[model samples]
Target: MMGFAVLLHVMAVVIWVGGMFFAYVVLRPVAAGQLEPPARLTLWAGVFGRFFPWVWACVGVVLATGLWMIFAVFGGMGGVGLYVHAMFGLGLLMMLIFFHVFFAPYGRLKRAVAAQDWQAGGKALAQIRMLVGINTLIGLLTIAVGAAGRYLVP
Candidate 1:
């Protein structure tokens, strides 16, 4: 059960963070250079339309598995180390940022695309880009904390 939890947790993290990395780093630049506003925005909207559902699933699995490990396995927060705390806090922050992106900007982006409002879509995309960038960095940090916490933390 513990192994399963860890596996699910790791997989969810990989999909979520890796998706953000690929989209922000690899896809964004190429799309911007090659496609015009309408196509690029549409492409992004399409991409998000496909990807966000996975993110939602990842978010659910990550949260559930993390908490399960924290409580069921380790006997809750008191049993965890400083690194675990850091990881948890960062994960929560990332979740909050993702929620904002999904609920606020992503919603706007969809509406703008439906209305063919490129400017509004652009604005929404810019917001998502910035937030995703921040979340990616934080995700990386969280991974580091999870990976190195036992060794480096208290």
Candidate 2:
């Protein structure tokens, strides 16, 4: 049961973090170089439409499995190490950032794309880009912490 919960948690993390990595690192540059603003915006909107739902689902799985492990396997917050606490804190921060991005800039991006407002879409996309960049960095750091934390954090 513990292993299963950990597996789910890791998979969710991989999906969310890996998606952000690809979007920010791989796709963003190619899209910007190849496509005009209108086409780029449309492509981003379409991409987000497909990706965000999976992110939301990943968020649910991560939260549920993480909490389950912390409680059921590790015997709750009090019983966990400093690394666990740090990971939890970082995870919550990442989730909050994601929620903000989804509700604010992402919402505006979708609307702008729908309305064919390239300028507005560009602005929204820029905001999403910055936020996702931050999240990706944090995600990488979190992964490092999760991987090496047991040995490092006393």
Candidate 3:
């Protein structure tokens, strides 16, 4: 059970963080360089349309597995170490950010694309990009905390 939990945890992180990396580093630059504003924005909208569902899944898995590990294995929230608490806090924050990005800017981007309003789509895409960059940084930090937290735990 512990091993399964660990696998789920790692896979969740990988999917979430890896998706962010692909969006920010690879897709962003490639779309910017290769496509016109309309095409680029439309492509981004399509990309997020596909990717956000996976992020939602990953978020659910991460939260479920993390809470299960804390409650079932650690005996409850009070039993969790400070580092685990920190990781959970930041991870929850990340999830909230993702929720905002998905429901707000991402939705706007999709609408703009559907309407063929390239400028509005670009603006919405920018909003999503900024939020995603912030979330990516937080996700990376959470991974660091997870890896090193045990040593720092009291």
Candidate 4:
């Protein structure tokens, strides 16, 4: 059970963090270079609309498996080492940023897109990009902490 939970946790992080990297590093540049504003914005809206649901799933799995591992396998919060605790903290921070992005700017983006308010859509997209970038960095940091956490404990 613990091993399966760990697998789920790892997969969730991969999908969420890897997706962000693909978006930021690969897709964003190609889209910006190839597509005009209207097409680009539309593409982003559709992409995010599809992607956010997966992200939500990832968040759910991460939280569930993380808590399960900490408590069920590791004997609760007190037994978790500093590195795991740091990773947990970073993960929570990433989740909060994602929630803000989803509820706030993402809503605005969807509304602006629906209303054909290209300027507003563009503004909202920028905000989402900035927030995602922040989350991506945090996600990367969390991965690092998770990887090294076991060894770095003092």
Q: lDDT per model, in order?
A: 0.95, 0.95, 0.91, 0.92
Candidate 1 CA-lDDT value:
0.95
Candidate 1 residue lDDT tens string, 113-152: 9999999999999999999999999999999999888988
TM-score of model 2 (CA atoms): 0.98
Q: Which of the two, 1 or 3, has more lDDT?
A: 1
* Model 2 C-alpha lDDT per residue in residues 56-129, reported as the tens digit of each score: 99999999998998898888899999998999999999999999999999999999999999999999999999
- The per-residue C-alpha lDDT of model 3 at residue 37 equals 87
List the candidate 2 regions with Cα displacement exceeding 4 Å.
none
Q: Order of all candidates by lDDT, from best down to worst?
A: 2, 1, 4, 3
With candidate 2 superimposed using the best TM-score fit, by how many Å does residue 29's alpha carbon deviate from the native?
0.3
Listed in order, each prediction's TM-score against the native is 0.98, 0.98, 0.97, 0.97
Mark the 10 consecutive residues where model 1 has the least summed lDDT: 145-154
Deviation in Å, model 3, residue 150 alpha carbon? 0.9
- Measured with C-alpha atoms, the lDDT of residue 94 in candidate 1 is 95
- The positional error of residue 153 in candidate 2, measured at the CA in angstroms, is 1.5
* lDDT for position 100 in model 1: 98
**Cα RMSD, each candidate:** 0.7, 0.6, 0.9, 0.8
C-alpha positional error of residue 87 in candidate 2 after TM-score superposition, expressed in Å: 0.4
Question: Model 3: how far is 147 from its true place, Å?
Answer: 1.4
